[model samples]
Target: MNGTIHNRDKFLNQIASRLNRPRISSKIQKPKWKYQPQHEVYKDATQDELLAVLEEHCKKIHTDIFTTDLQGLPAVVNDVVANCGGGPVVTWKDERFSEWGLDSVMKKEWPSQQIDVFEWDHTLGEENIDKAENANVGITISEITLAESGTVVLFSDKDKGRTVSFLPKASIMLIPKSTLVPRMTQAAVKMREVYQKTGHVASCINFITGPSNSADIELNLVVGVHGPIKATYIVVNDL
Candidate 1:
């Protein structure tokens, strides 16, 4: 115990001596102001125009398009699959979605359980991930995300499971208009608001930009390396 105390004292004295020995004077550092400037005033087009923009962008990116009327999502999902291709495995967990009439919307030839809706608990160890990865289509509802950069923010809570977005062939996300922020900085501000109010931190937070892509080997851009090959973002205007 005596030797340990002496070692601690020696460390403290060394730190103090180093602090006291700094004698060189330097000019005060000027703050870096606005490295990247943001727009002074924000302007958005009409709802129809915005939807048109989204559709055009999605088409250019070769993403299967879908929209949620917020009245009945299960029905909308049916059209989304039919538009993409028949026989897609629609995986959803929300009870409301299940109740929104999925069984009836599916085609007769498709198996009864092809559209599998399971109630998932995040506590379940890696099982949901396996299910999502095997699925052809995965659906999720985001709390909010930035529309401009096409970024989807998953809060990584019990309801918004991580695998829902990450481990699927294709992702279909439903984001309410009330939660849509324009830019990345706004996303941080919204997160801060939640932190200040709830005092609750998440287990994980993911910011997904488009589909999983990589250019590791031969410097050639490759898609679907880490996650889904295709992603569809459905911005629900009505919250």
Candidate 2:
């Protein structure tokens, strides 16, 4: 039995015994309700306008934003990696990286000892995670980019682990223009559609607005206490 069900049954049985009645096995049901947005602000903004809004919010949160075409992505990636001083780099095993020839570009620009691509079937389990945790730079693709809040959504899977985004000193996300949405509501609807079609959702869905920060102790602000110290989003126009 599920732990929840077993505990519920045990409690119900104890109550029934005290009351001199039989325990019930019926399940409780709750009414389902549809969620309606109170305000649909910027529902009609153009792509350029949305991008501008996203850039403004990103700046407020101290997230660096870079815009480039598909052909320029490799050069942009190279620059970000170079800024990290050529330490261990971790990336997802996404096909988009290969399609954009990032592998070849990294090989040409950096040595083989500097890059580590995470593969799902690899046997280097704990060792691989350690490398990613110590990496100077981590790169991944964003599933959804909410322009309204300057948030990037990532779904973790076997190939795309959550550590790739959280463990590194600096995190870089390559977001395609098509993945950009006007608001978080639209991003949620899109993810719902994906789950409906696939009959499954990722184990973890992370919504990152900017670099990790906390101001809990004595109202002193600290960045990267739990995640990357720096975060960058590269928006590719010609996805």
Candidate 3:
């Protein structure tokens, strides 16, 4: 410990000497100003228009988009799962799924499907990750959906790990209409509000536009190379 401390001090002193200043032990204050851009696009679209834009962009990016009312969400989810070949499914432990009646619906509709819910206790970390990695389908809830980019914002927490979305062969996100925003700026503002209320932010905030794709290898496009090959968004309209 003493040697490590001495080395750290020597490193800091060398930098301080080069700058001709003494070492300081103070935290830098973050900027407080909000810079509003002069021109903002897609800011005044009606709800219907925003949905149309989202659908168009999603299709362009090769993301499968489905719309349903609250009552029909269960059926939509069932269809998505069925289309994925009746998966061994992994899901985040979110209360919203239960509130939306998805938990019961899955039990009834997909009796043979193996469903695993992730738990973040220390002992279960590796086991949970393995389950997610092996699962055919992974389902998650989108905190916010940016219509301008057709992107969904996912905040990773104990319940929702980063692997839940990236590891599976197919990923499904449940997005409520009320959570849709016009642009990335609006999504960031909502994230800030969440931080302010919770006094903390998640470790990972993923903005996913579509399935993982790369066109860099010999200019040949490949999908799902680094992540899920297929992505689906179930937009709940009557949320």
Q: Candidate 3, residues 78-166: lDDT per residue as tens digits?
A: 89977876577888878888788886665555664544444334358688888888888888888899898889989987777878898
Residue-level lDDT tens digits of model 2 in 91-122: 87788887877876655556655454443323
Candidate 1, residue 221: lDDT = 78
Which 10 consecutive positions of candidate 2 have the poorest summed lDDT? 113-122
- What is the alpha-carbon lDDT for the whole of candidate 2? 0.82
TM-score each candidate: 0.69, 0.82, 0.82
Q: RMSD to native for every prediction?
A: 6.6, 4.2, 4.1
CA error at residue 83 for candidate 1, angstroms: 5.0
Q: Quote the lDDT for 212 in model 3.
A: 92
For each candidate, the alpha-carbon lDDT, in order, equals: 0.64, 0.82, 0.82
- Model 2 ranges off by over 4 Å: 1-39, 112-122
Give the range of the ten consecutive residues with the poorest summed lDDT in model 1: 36-45
TM-score (C-alpha) between model 2 and the true structure: 0.82
